[model samples]
Target: MAIQKQEFIERMKRLQASVRLSELEAFLVTAQDSIFYLTGVTYSPLERPFFILVRPDTGVVLLAPTLDRDHLASAPNVDEVRAYWDYPSPPGLGWSDGLLELVAGIRLLGVEPSLTQEIAQVISAWQPQAVPLIERLRLVKSADEVAMLRQAASYADLGMQKIIQAAYYGVSEIEIFSQGRAVQIQIIKETEFDPLNTSVLTAAWPARLGTQPHGVPSIADRLKDGPHIGLSFLRANGYAAECERTFFVTSPSQNMSEMFTLMLEARNRAFALIRPGVPCAEIDRAANGFLRQEGLGDYLLHRTGHGFGLGNHEGPWVAEGSPDVLEENMLISVEPGLYIPGLGGFRHSDTVLVTSDGYESLTRYPTEIEALTLLARRSMTRLRGALVRKAVGVA
Candidate 1:
């Protein structure tokens, strides 16, 4: 999906502004994500390298392989666009030949860290810049980026809803995973959004049975565990968000209810602390501290959350001792998890936009107890109730 002409212009302008201030004549972007962020083009980087050169006076130049030229056909801010037949140019030159030749005369060049060593060697003096220009610029969201993120989050929520609806005692993990992916794909098609990527996971048990934290669901694996976890992560173009919920294969025991209640409380506590100018570390501490107070600290595994946008896991991590500070319009996840060696991992995550004053949740899948009950009968009854309510116009 190509970014609007005006959005592309604004982005290049920002790059130019940064370049001018740094006394750099041009910015060389080699990172795939960086190029996608600046020009709304993505392809198989392995087959062919893509480069976006941004000059203070020349706007932007995109050098891509012929195979991916159509992705940039409608992109704006590209003052000059060129394409090579394939890598290892016909003249026996290297992959960096075309891009290096384009910016050969640049006195001082700005670069993203993803620049290959060979590419840097072609330049006169490759003094690496401190922070990646594109990543720094992407730390804050424009109105358009926020809109894309909102759309991605909506699809994630819808996928999660479908997952719980499909939950059953005998259902195979692969079955639910397929259904969830299909629903998200359907949403993208119906909404006229471009084809995107999604991850749907179903966990039948905790580490108690040596269940790996991350796994691909197998057709043979069924949801026979008392409770299972369903995680939905969706990406729209490059933007993405994640939502996770716990499902019970049968009626949850009193202890399971209590543990989940604690997890929800931890997630909420962390959510309340998100805002512009706050130290990102405190957010993690808030959740971690609460979990400790409830005697669940020992079960902590990863950080509270991480900033997300073009990259699912980016800067401003909500982890203990992190130095980054939160900023307005920064997208973050509030996923506080507790993993007991035998019981299972307890985690509930929601993507939120750090706003000017506070924060706004983007994912709105049902987190309440009634909706997450995995008991075959109870869940089916609720699903029927939802359908009935919709039919009666009172859902």
Candidate 2:
């Protein structure tokens, strides 16, 4: 809801510059992320379609739903705002009708890659290449974007504090998530992170039954064992930061603790390699390579991390063979995790800011195994036992 005109001006200036250099008559955006980056207003891309047309000669032309007129009014640097009626063709106009009006005189136009095939059919003659200009521009964060990321990272860290408290023995995954989510909502509200924009809260954990990366959090899945971890993906004001921690209900089994230490070491190794000029792939190798060397490579689920901003998962991916190069002020998550079916997952993710000299960790939670260990609270539900072989405590 809070719109910054200066940010919008700066983005438009950069986009215009890119347009001039590329000889594009105009740049068009259809994806929510691309439109949000340029217009400072993000809408849910559900039934209704939205479009932002950026012309070098003209300012910005927005084709959006009439209901969002007030919201788009707050947007900075936007010139022409045309609100189409509801979807499914309302007699005279629809999304394609709006597009046809905009590109009537334009010779060449470049559009966001995410624009649907049906929408592209309206302007296919222009031959849009899904230009990398906007994506590349988004890779480097402005001062304000970095500031928002820090706030989002702090929000994630705040949630982890409560999640650790809630992950006691006999605590249901759902119970832990609910308590932690409540506290995090307050934190997000306090930070003034816009909930209407991107996913502004948290997707927390102790929600899973085992080591798999993807699992639904259920009340039936209770923590009774060695490692109870929570992964928090917190979005503050449309920008997101990833933070996660591994905690033990009781003392971790020797293997769990040792593997956790190794995971931390891997994360640290990736941290040390971050700088302005390094290739993104090297960061992945620094972390994943270590895990592979330790014989835990088979347990790896995802990349070392990826870029985060307006898009929850953006460009400059930190994965092996990635084509992106690290730059100052670009934020990435270096989460090096290892998971085994019966033992549960051990991954520590942090929002790392690629600084001028090196990297600064935005998510500053204690990683010490002892600090993460929690004592059992009163049982919330009667979970038979853990999917994990042994709970350090009685289930």
Candidate 3:
């Protein structure tokens, strides 16, 4: 099971109990993601709103359109399912009225910020005296929650390895991307979590010969030479993981040999500093500090990394200005990238969990840039040989 029923009730209790919300008997949860976070039943990211009424002291009550009831019931930790009717079914004769009836005695109602205005207005009119409660109490994660995040991170690592394996001479960036999707699907299925979304490599070299790889060309663009660049955008169980590395289609350049070493070192520096109780901003500073000292500060692009779980990105940002403090169960990515404008960039990212003592690197894939460069070189050599054969045949 994704999450246990008792676990969800416990989570809900934790949420309400944290803020001394005993007076709030029922919380109106409209955010679908929160519903999944609390219920562990994530079907789809639909526009249709779902509601969960919880009386921290009591239990959970779910409301959605009639069509979604069966699937919602299948969710691991959900109970007391209710639904509203659409089409020819009578209007205003559904879960809305039941929801209103359910919370009759509740004076304090909790809601997420993303609640639709229409729902808010109706809710307010129904209970004019009820105070609205904000469910922003979900920032911190528990140990179990961190485990699921670690699982998702593992899937991402597998996907990267699959990309490396599929990369070879004459293969287009799109082909590598296809292989990545297959790997993502396989990993998610093994974990029994629904696949959210996946994006693989953009291994195109620039039109100019001898220039570094990372350029955002049109989809129709072709590699001027070899050394195809690889990028993958993957989401495992709705948690997003992005990774990119440059590969030589045949042979790695002399510069690539040195850049790969620096990339791996920078990644290691960031990983070693990640620990529970550390300030989130300091994580970025620590990683950036190393790059700056190496005189490669100008090559850095994005922040050190971002938190991951449930949704692709979440709390405890690994960027500057993030005052969020790391906790034992919080999961985040420790990625550092060196992107030179005209030259290609190199980056290594892995999802990690903060532990009681220190941290756990969920991903075990080797991010040593040299290995990837060598892989690129081998692929490029094969492509060059094939091209030469074709030309000779035509002549």
Question: Model 3 off-target regions past 4 Å?
Answer: 19-26, 74-79, 87-91, 94-108, 117-147, 193-229, 237-246, 250-262, 292-299, 375-395
lDDT of model 2 at position 52: 76
- Per-residue lDDT of candidate 1, residues 1-395 (tens digit): 32466886688788888888778878888887777677664455886777777778765778887767777755666767778778766773545667667777677677877777666776746564534778778888888789878877887787787777776666555555555656556655755465533343323432233224465555445565544667777676567888888767667778777888888998888988888989988998899889998887677778898988887788768898888899999999998877766566677788899999999999998887778776655565446544544554442
Q: Which candidate would rank higher by TM-score, 1 or 3?
A: 1
Q: Compute the lDDT of residue 201 as modeled in candidate 1.
A: 37
Prediction 2 TM-score vs. true: 0.89
Each model's TM-score?
0.85, 0.89, 0.75
| Residue lDDT tens for model 3, 1-395 | 25557777666666556335545555677776677666667666465567877665555677777888888887554558887774234656655565676667766666666767767776885453233333234455666666665666655666666666755554444444445656655765686656543333323343232234344544333343333445555665545555555555455566656765776777777777777788888878878777888898777767887877665566668888988888776778776777655455566666777888888777767665457643344655446435544544421
Best candidate per lDDT, number?
2
- After superposition of all CA atoms, the RMSD between model 2 and the true structure is 4.6
Ranking by TM-score: 2, 1, 3
In the range 227-345, model 2's lDDT, one tens digit per residue, is 76677676667778877888877678888888889999998899889999999999899999999998888888889989988766887899997999999999888887888777778
The model with the greater lDDT, 2 or 3, is 2
